[model samples]
Target: MALSARELWRILEPVHGMIYFVPEAQERFAALGLDRMAGYFASRAAALGPVSGEVVVATFYNFNPVIVHAAVPAAWSVTTPAALVEARYEAVGAALRRGLGELADDVSELAGLVRGAAERACEVPQGRPLFAAHAALAWPEDPLLVLWHGQTLLREFRGDGHVAALLLEGLSGIEALVVHAASGEVSAEALRRSRGWSEAEWADAVEGLRSRGVLDAEGGLSEAGLAVRARVEGLTDSAAEVAYAGLGEGERERFVELARPLSRAVVASGMLPFAKR
Candidate 1:
């Protein structure tokens, strides 16, 4: 069977996502005088070279600007972007080393495979600001970190596409979260709280989506809403297909084969208990 872009992302996402939930990241960021929220904003945005919170808000696309503003630019005052980047790398390496154990030794081939796709994606950086920023960074020598970085690049590339898809569907950031929450994968409360949106703001978004027929009376996706969601996801997948242009079908399958176990290990390590799709 041919691997779809969504399947490929499902296989590799865990490896890239574990960094957000790992304790090592928090510890390392704390050492640099950053708390959890500040650390998250700083570490992820560091690749962009000490940009303002507005830039982060524009690129990140979901978080409340107040939350972003509270962390960024201020984060630059406490530590340099170079240092934050190093800290995140150190944290990812430590967490993966501890989590993957012996599997960490055999990541060279997987790293190469993922890097090929990531570099290919880098070639078309026209609108992928976050991915472009990470792509400009120096590649790490360690295979495990290489795998992590490569997956991070692809994740951001796909994320940028997702944002574009949402915009094409005429959904605002909060409305996007509302649609996602209605999908039953994640709760509206969790999305609202995590993004720093108040209940009233969330309720207003829900009402807006409801008025647009994207949500039914029960707050779940109606038929039109489901179609809209499907279109957005399909468009996102289409956009991400460019990353795998250089990989033959067999190589793509092999990439998934090689990555599945590592991603499973990352999931089983209990380091990503809070991670959601």
Candidate 2:
């Protein structure tokens, strides 16, 4: 698609949330199967680096620390029925319980690791705090399901300056930027009416988003951008396992690195998204 100048600029610019969901996120759900969880993790690791993986795992443990932590040691158990997998599960559980305990007590340290990792790997912009965007794209009505979700993501970062409106301009017809506003799904028509812009003016706005790299003709986010947005959110979701316990520096960094390649593999194969895949 022939993007306008604004569009091109938007595409080139750093989006606050594009670098999410990477390959390594799968480990966050190694036992249950990655599904959307895998792709989401990969995207984050790619953008934020491999360290965030710990954050993701911490979240995972919070949700069901007992179960997820147990998955590992179970494989090495020595008892008749429990020796193989059950023992191994217990071993893994013991280690996680301790890791989670220490992190639950330290906030500054965890924030420091997040800050350093955010700055180092994500190349965070000058100001503001950027947490992963939290949203549920699709879900199953079935109550039996208790595994990963199939929701791709877009993060919200601290841009150097105001860019949401600019992003709208850049997407234009080339890329229809979509945001679930309070009213409903915000789309081009909605922007046109609310902004009171002529077709030319709207096109101009979209052009801007494209240039910033927030909007692209192929899709809203570029490959790397999508990776970042997805990765951050994925980690956040993975962290659910651990809940308030959060993550420490070492563990968070470790996860980000390990999940990188696996996330890529799932996305590349088109099996990351639960429903479509």
Candidate 3:
């Protein structure tokens, strides 16, 4: 099948999420002395540099600024950027090594393909802030580590663009969550708790979306809602296209072919919570 940007995104999502959302990965970070929120700060800050709480909030998109600020100390106080970079590389490498093991052999097996994709992705001049920062970072020498980093950069590239699309569409955070939920990207309750919105606040946002004809009474997206969602996705894909534009004729397909097995190994290892779609 010819992959649309959305389909390509699905292939990449779990691979990227494994580093941050996997139970074992979280536990490993905890072992390294980072709590849930702190782990988020440490990883993101390391990649984004010693940025302020507000910048993190803007780049992260969905979470409340206050909530993001609470996690900022994990990055600023505990480790310098250089140290955190090394630490993040170590942590992610450990998780993937444990998860992929013999199935992936060594970093050598995947390094060139990852490097090609990343180098191509970096060629895109215009990018949202988070993706831009990550793309500017030096690639790691360990092939496995570089593979993870490359995927992270690509994921953030899409994410930053998606956030811009949502904003351009005039969707508030809760409303954005409502649309995402209605489309089944994430559960509404999970998004609410993750974003630190109160239950009443979430309900009000749902009602607001319904009032706007973006959602129906049962909290599903109506036709208008679906159209709006599709526009957001289309805009996101458009913004994200520059990164992939550098790929040579067949390279996108080749990159996907090379990446799929490694990604699947990570998923099958039960390291990430992403349900196969």
In lDDT terms, which candidate is top?
1
Task: Write the residue-wise lDDT of candidate 2 on 185-211 in tens digits.
Answer: 345565454323466755665566456
Once fitted onto the true fold, the runs of candidate 1 whose alpha carbons sit more than 4 angstroms away are: 275-277
List the candidate numbers ranked by TM-score, top first.
1, 3, 2
lDDT of each: 0.92, 0.31, 0.73
Model 1, residue 36: displacement in angstroms? 0.2
What is the lDDT, from 0 to 100, of the residue 225 in candidate 3?
A: 95
lDDT of 3 by residue, 1-277 (tens): 4455555556656666776776654665566677877776667766678788887777777776677888775456765666656666777878777777874465564456555655766777374678778887888877777777877777777888888899989897677887898898788887888788788988898899899999888989999999999999899888766656666546668666766777788778887664552
Q: Which ten residues in a row have the lowest lDDT in candidate 3?
A: 103-112
User: Best by TM-score, which number?
Assistant: 1
Better structure of 1 and 2 per lDDT = 1
Clash pairs, model 1 backbone: none
lDDT of 1 by residue, 136-211 (tens): 9999999999999999999999999999999999998989999999999998888899899999989999999999
TM-scores across all candidates? 0.97, 0.21, 0.88
- Shift of residue 254 alpha carbon in model 1, Å: 1.2
Q: Whole-model lDDT, candidate 1?
A: 0.92
- Which stretches of candidate 3 lie above 4 Å from their native place? 23-28, 31-33, 73-75, 106-110, 125-127, 274-277
